[model samples]
Target: MARPYEPGPSTSLSTNTLSQTPSSPVPEEDDDSGAASPELPLTMSASVMLADLPRDATAALASVGGFPQEKVVVKFKPVGAAPSLAQELCKISATRKFEEVVRYLRRKLRCKDTDSVFLYVNSAFAPSLDEVVGNLHQCFKNGQDQLIVAYSMTPAFG
Candidate 1:
């Protein structure tokens, strides 16, 4: 059976202080001062920075690895009403629609028939705080409570 949890002797209290105070109990046994404490690791999911996604995700998913680069998923969305392409791209970034903005650029932005490519989101951005709170139960049950997606960004790697 697993050992029951105990309130460890207060490591933070100094031995001198304990000695001065007769009522205090002896210090708890410690394996080593340098040894790491038994603690839970953060439950956060890893995020995929735009540049790293293509090389990293593809290598792990062989189906993606050998496939043509053009077949890779492209996320984009248009931002603000703008006739100028640069303005539109700038608006996308400012709005934080990481996926949607990229998609729009892929289809619209061009130079000598070549496009200056990057990531974008089509949506408003990471979901609002209320939306996240609403999904908290589902997230917790699925071990995804720590997983947070920005309202505009579809979280490149979930």
Candidate 2:
């Protein structure tokens, strides 16, 4: 019969004292700190320096070395409390920045500097303004081959 593991003072038990196979290594009661315990590596901690990593992450965006030849179709979508555009669809140079789309929306809406316009792709996430439009379209375009951009006057998605 096995006794309850009383993990203190080396557990001077008559039954366990003469065991062949060693039990799991447990921390002694004297050890107050978890110094021997291993820690899990954080995903966010794994970062690369700018010098080590490429500036452009995608091949689609890296094609900017050549002249702006390809055009991506951008379809505007209105989110909660946002007004819709007169023309929902538009064609833009693939090499252009996402900032261009934001600027275009601002212009169409006649938004002042004080007015904030938030834009998201696929109504899921907001891309950086500096991100290339071609890369976004290539990665997240809808079935109709259109880059669906959802815009909102206020914060919509987390």
Candidate 3:
């Protein structure tokens, strides 16, 4: 009969035996100099994952066609030394510019070349003439759903 099989310590596999194999190349050590060694080049993959984001509501509305024109109500309040118009409340197109409001006030007051008129929104800072009246009214309308504008012959609130 053949001899019975026997387990021995030398028959077991170990990390030392695997690393000693000739398949992998060993790194060489540099000379004992004080100079820094060059680093290995990094490798990267170019694949990227992009997430879908929702579109802006305003931009979506604009693409269908520009914002619809609406009638805006303007309430005029005269400051110190400023003359009031015959009609304090008037309706204007939302697409009109603030300069149009200034011109309308000037025409109603019959202002002279030397006269100056200043307009403010909510008695606060003065907006640029090029600003759209509709945009301003939408942003700063009073509780009555009216654009409250204060006018003065001289600079009052600056």
Please report the candidate that would top lDDT against the real structure: 2
Rank by lDDT, descending?
2, 3, 1
lDDT of 1: 0.33
TM-score for each of the candidates: 0.17, 0.58, 0.60
Per residue, candidate 3 scores C-alpha lDDT tens digits across 40-153 of: 221233234557435686568665534244778999999998987889998889889999999988999999979999999999979999999988988899898899999999
What stretches of model 3 exceed 4 Å from their correct place?
Answer: 1-59, 63-69
Task: Compose the digit string of candidate 1's lDDT tens values, residues 1-158.
Answer: 43433434442444687566533233333677654344522112422346556765776886532322221222223333322344321222222333443344445544234433323222323433223222322322223222222122123323
Give the better candidate number (1 or 2) by lDDT: 2
**Global fold similarity of model 2 (TM-score):** 0.58
**Whole-model lDDT values for every prediction:** 0.33, 0.80, 0.77
Q: How many backbone clashes does candidate 3 have?
A: 0
Which candidate achieves the best TM-score against the true structure?
3
Which is the better candidate, 2 or 3, if ranked by lDDT? 2
List the RMSD of every prediction in angstroms.
17.1, 13.0, 18.2
- What local lDDT score does residue 62 receive in model 3, on the 0 to 100 scale? 61
lDDT of 1 at 51: 52
For candidate 2, the per-residue lDDT at 36 reads 37
Tens digit of lDDT per residue, candidate 2, span 2-25?
334454443344455666544343
